[model samples]
Target: MDHRSETGHVMFLSPERVFYAGLLGRPRNRSTGSLLIYVGLGGRLMLTCGGRTQADLAIALIPPFVEHTIASDARSSLCFTVEPESVTPAALDLLARRAADQGPALAERICAAYVRLREGGCGPGFTTEELDTIVLGAPLARRRLDLRIAEAVARLNDFSGPAATAADCAAAARLSQSRFLHLFKQQTGTSFRAFRAHKRARHLLHFVNEDLNFAHLAQDIGYPDSTHFCHSIRRFYGLKPGAIFSGSRDLRIYRGAAQAEATAVAALA
Candidate 1:
């Protein structure tokens, strides 16, 4: 028998296998014997699974026989599933009695462990056990508006040349244009347009060495015309696009400046 096929079957039998496998974005096809818990930290997520209202940092303790889908707004996450019969009776009873407030410290630890795991570092052996303990202790809180907005801002840090509009960002966030603008301002303490322009300027500084066509770069990043794009760059960074990319300044200077600006904006958000 193929080990891969057997592995699939075994995934349903053990809670550890079930929990870790869920984190990889694929769940076993059958939900009849699984319970899933989603803990959102700093971003927005959309769940396709039948559930209550959509909100930031939403948590759903899905019982057996329910299937769900989850989407997040450029933020990291930690999710797990438990086999119905694998969890101790004591653990199930605790989960039934707890409220959402009891999961922050657990969330924090999970987030930290996830980061370490992503970086190829050795995570503490007790991390998963601690996570299980937290889930049993209390309900996990929802994500905050400020963190979601900050995540939006962070996404822009990778943009270069020209900036996208609030409407574009709203579509990305899956929110109404008006609501996105309001929420963006509330969380980032800046207008969406301003933040986008800053992001574009930072990208241009980083990519100026590449023999990219200004017009194409502008259009690629959502600007309508080269003239308008250059004008925006000049107004914000006090340097025309051509002049900055002309090789006058040391490449290191441009890189350092851009990184500093991006860092400052992130900190502000």
Candidate 2:
């Protein structure tokens, strides 16, 4: 492994999606809402989930809300996450099975794409579709969801504002609370509360490169207090709030270009 490759890390973050190429910090159990694909950059990675541990794996896929831990023989890895709501369940399941005993062919392609991304000086402008095509050979099919559920999904992605509640979204969608909750799970394969929690924790990525106080940062991102904030971060990321911040100090972070532009335009409005 080239020593220089391990020194620089970058993260690409968009709404409900993330591509992180960096350190594989100390392994700890984490259950996340997004489907995860981890590829070891230097060599095979070890994976443990569902009472089974697999080694010598070039790639591994973990479904949403499945508690799992991963570690690699190398210093860095390429991790990509997809929001389950954006793809059909069947598509996700097929990928998960393929990754369980995945070989090096597809893994090699993904690693090569990462090299191209780094060498091309690609910034926030990169789209998820582009990433899918480059690495997966094609864009994963999109899920056609109910309009009402889609409306609620849009609100959930805006984690920087007040947390959206089931009641609030149900009312907005002209449905009763119970019915909305049922429909949400049926359509998205996760409960509203669980999805919201993941989004809130994921939103912290936007601040990884910023210097800020933890307590204030917690409040700004819709957490009730710093304790709850720290707990949630650890649950989903396997790292404490302070540790995440400190570790990402030198990492290059980029938000989706369209998202960044939208935020800027809203600010100037």
Candidate 3:
């Protein structure tokens, strides 16, 4: 098999979202908190979930927290991860339709946008709205969350800040813990714990290119220990922490304005 790595791929990162176009390393089961959209760049893609394998797929949309393994015959792919809380049900339904149809039209547009961003000399300052416009033809309608739930969501998404527990967020929102958890699920369409875990895993992308100690990194990200960190990373990304870092070495990452201040290497290209 040809083992030459595809270098110089691009990734755009923003709050509650990520767009990645790069190598699809060895596939393993991964269950992530973000609704996943996978688009093949070359040959057909294969997706296996729930004991069933679907082959010759050009596009697939997998909901959040679904355990699945995906691979592309071409060895690389275009993937977009939409945080469940960010979009309305209607938008998600539209995405589902597109994915179900194996949207050649949508996939072609997304591929063009990727090419534009990669060769256009753009930096990481783009907003999520702009990203949506370029890739999906318009901004995805935002889900209107409750004020209290929105506050809690903000706290959880701010990965650079001190970790906030459910109790902390509940207290800040002035609600009982039970009520808070219930409302969080109702508004976000995910449990508070699952959302937090996904945020922690997503935050790892900010430091993927850096040389950092795993133990300390674990603590920095609020993981109880290195073992938990490794397990969570593997669960979400289907790759070990070390493997993620190594694979991302040649990948150029663009962080939105919110993350640019927290991660200096977001300027890398």
Candidate 4:
């Protein structure tokens, strides 16, 4: 293993996802809201899960909120955390199951995209949607969701206020608590609470670059107390808040290309 990838670089950050290129110091075991695709850009990596180490991999796909650790040589790597529903299911399953080796092909495309960005041929680098499209090829069949349930998901994603409860979601979707709960699980393949928590946890992404301390950051993101904030961070990212926050210190966080551009403009203003 190379000892060179100890340096880390963050390329983009948003509420829904983030992309990183460069060395990632040891990451916390916190679960994340979106699916994680850790692409090995240079040296080989060692991914540890459930007390085991998976080394010599070109890429790894981790499902949301599943705790794991990655040990890598100090080499360049590219990573993206993509929104669950926004990514095509076929692509997600392909990487997650490890049923086949798509690593070489995926790596080639990523390298090309990186090269193009470095040459300033494009602006804002690659995006989650673009990467998903590149990997998945054509569109795949989507799960048929109840319109009401789908509306509820939209609301969940958009809601910025207090933590939404099951009752609240049911009301928003215009369904009884029981019926809505049933449909939500069937349509989304996860319990309502888990889905909502992941959505809520994603709110922390916006503040990744803020100067605020944990207390204020927690409140600003709608966590009830420090305890809840810490717990939520752990569950979402599988690591302690302090570790995650400290690890991201040098990251140039952004919500999107527009937000990043706006921030740059404001700095000059």
The prediction achieving the highest lDDT against the true structure is 3
Rank the models by TM-score, top first: 3, 2, 4, 1
lDDT winner between candidates 2 and 4: 2
Q: TM-score for model 4?
A: 0.76
User: Per-residue lDDT tens digits of candidate 4, residues 14-101?
Assistant: 3344666655656555566577777777666678877787888777777876778875564567776766655456756865664247
TM-score of each: 0.37, 0.91, 0.92, 0.76
Q: What is the C-alpha local distance difference test score of each model?
A: 0.48, 0.83, 0.84, 0.63
Better of 3 and 4 by lDDT: 3
Q: State the local distance difference test value for candidate 4.
A: 0.63
Mind giving the per-residue lDDT tens digits that candidate 2 earns over 85-140? 99988888877766655657778877887887676545666776776776677877
Please list the residue runs of candidate 1 whose C-alpha ends up more than 4 Å from where it truly belongs after superposition. Answer: 1-145, 160-164, 172-174, 248-250, 253-269
- Residues 1-269 of candidate 3: C-alpha lDDT, one tens digit per residue: 22222464779898856888888778999998888988888778899999999999878889989999999998679998888798998898988887667577877887787787777534677787888887787888899999999988887777677888999999999999999999999998888998899998888987886789999999988899999999999999999999888877777788887777655533452
True lDDT of residue 120, candidate 3: 52
Q: After aligning candidate 4 to the native by TM-score, how far in Å is the CA of 41 from where it should be?
A: 3.8
Off by over 4 Å in 2: 1-7, 100-102, 265-269
RMSD of each: 20.5, 3.1, 3.9, 5.5
Number of clashes in every candidate structure?
A: 5, 0, 0, 12
Clashing residue pairs in candidate 2 (N, C-alpha, C atoms within 3 angstroms): none
